[model samples]
Target: MSKFKKKTGTSQDIPTSALPDIIFMLLFFFMVTTVLRETDLLVEQKIPAATQLQKLEKKSLVSYLYIGKPKNAALYGTEPRIQANDAIISVDDIFRWVTEEKDKLSEIERDQITISLKVDQEVKMGPITDVQMELREANARKVLYASIKKVDL
Candidate 1:
């Protein structure tokens, strides 16, 4: 009724100036904290403990061989199996596998390649011996046995 009019509507806007900053911060956080898994273990590994252990200097020059019982016993059976990379392979496959792995490296670094055997504690020496024989045949002389540090009680 007077010179001034009555205001009834209010603003409903949300502040989004910090939205991009929040999103970028979240992205950076995940990039820093996330760890990518290299391989999926098909077999159960319970490494044996050793008193005298030496750490490998260059992991890139090492090829890993996992020997243990299959986690899916019903499918792969209860016997100890050999795993190279991701697939389960046989004893005879060791020679071919070693050759292929060595071929992937430079000629100079070929001799420096180390074969690391990660065998389960319960597995018998028969499989280990077979693997060693195959490695010898392949001329991959440098071998390293993977083991945990023995903790004295």
Candidate 2:
């Protein structure tokens, strides 16, 4: 027999025990990088209770606006409407800003713009209603209230 042993690669090659580390690392990386949901700006707002609130069949078309009370201001995204503390942003603009990813939506999906209010519970009714009134003038399809849902761990 030749001095050289069989040189073919074995079927039992490198084991896959190392793969889980790579997958776990990738998973952790994505989890850390993921964006968390934003909390409402108004800390004082006692989110109204919903005895039976149905989750919107779809995501919000509603632009985020906070009724920053005492000095009632229209707060949206990270920008606050200073000039009109009680500023009523146009529904047309609301549509654009809230639905910036519109081409992803079908035509019927384009038209429905909902307004979500995060008014402080202690705040007077006038501004709250005024906000709703403006949205109605903008021909908003729905004006929804943002309430805190209680959950049990």
Candidate 3:
């Protein structure tokens, strides 16, 4: 009855124009930040703590050798085994493995290659001594023992 009319309806839909941009930004962020694991450990290793620890400078020059009891006890038994690269290998295979690894590098970088031993705290010295002897025969003298830094009580 009055000159002004009532406006009862309003736009209720949310604007989705920026939704795709936000999604793509999040995808890119995760892709850049996530670090993929390089090696899948077959052996169970609990690295022993060391009083004196020195960090390796170049990770590129280092190749890891894992020594511990097999995770699959039913198949591999409960005895300690050696793991190089991805597969579990015997002590006799050490020389061949080391040679092949050195062959992958250039002549200038061959001598700089370091063998990192990641031995479990529960392991005995016999297997380690055999591995060391094989390494000596292979002439891969650069050796590093990987261990956690001990915290003082």
Candidate 4:
């Protein structure tokens, strides 16, 4: 009878010298590419879901308009309000706000600027209509309705 023995080799550990560099590169990539929300939402936004949704072409040329009830209804009332940047303003203020927003861009870029309206689904059409009229007066014609993608069940 003959006995055979199998050879065993020592395990080699992976080189971790480049690990920190890889991790730092990934972190920097995310930091640079991620678009952090510039303004916090003071009002509750329940964006309606839609089947047909398109991505906004240019983020730099886009300004957001939030319309919904204030997060703290006790302090700001339950009525729907317009939120431009960080401030909650009346519908009448939309013109000035749009003007200021448009002015931020150069003359060549002005035509490409889009005003994205984030309106709550539960809200009435009156406020939306008023905002549209104000936007027209402000000469900010490019408008977009921001909504979530509706999932098909």
| Top candidate, metric TM-score | 3
Candidate 2: tens digits of C-alpha lDDT, residues 37-140 = 66434334456666567687666454556654323334444322211213445433443444443344567765675556776566667656655665565555
Q: Candidate 3, residues 1-116: lDDT per residue as tens digits?
A: 89998898888999999999999999999999999877889899999999998878888888889999999999889999999988999999999999998999999999998999
Instruction: Give all TM-scores, in the order shown.
Output: 0.79, 0.53, 0.81, 0.81
Residue 119 lDDT, candidate 4, scale 0-100: 94
| TM-score comparison, 1 vs 4, better candidate | 4
Top candidate when judged by lDDT against the true structure = 1
Give model 2's clash tally: 0
| Reference-based lDDT, residue 21, model 2 | 100
What overall lDDT goes with each candidate model?
Answer: 0.94, 0.56, 0.93, 0.91
Candidates arranged by lDDT, highest first: 1, 3, 4, 2
**How much is the lDDT of residue 9 in candidate 1?**
89
Model 1 agreement with the true structure over 23-93: per-residue lDDT tens digits: 99999999999988767889999999999988788988999999999999998999999999898999999
Clashing pairs in 1: none
Better of 1 and 3 by TM-score: 3
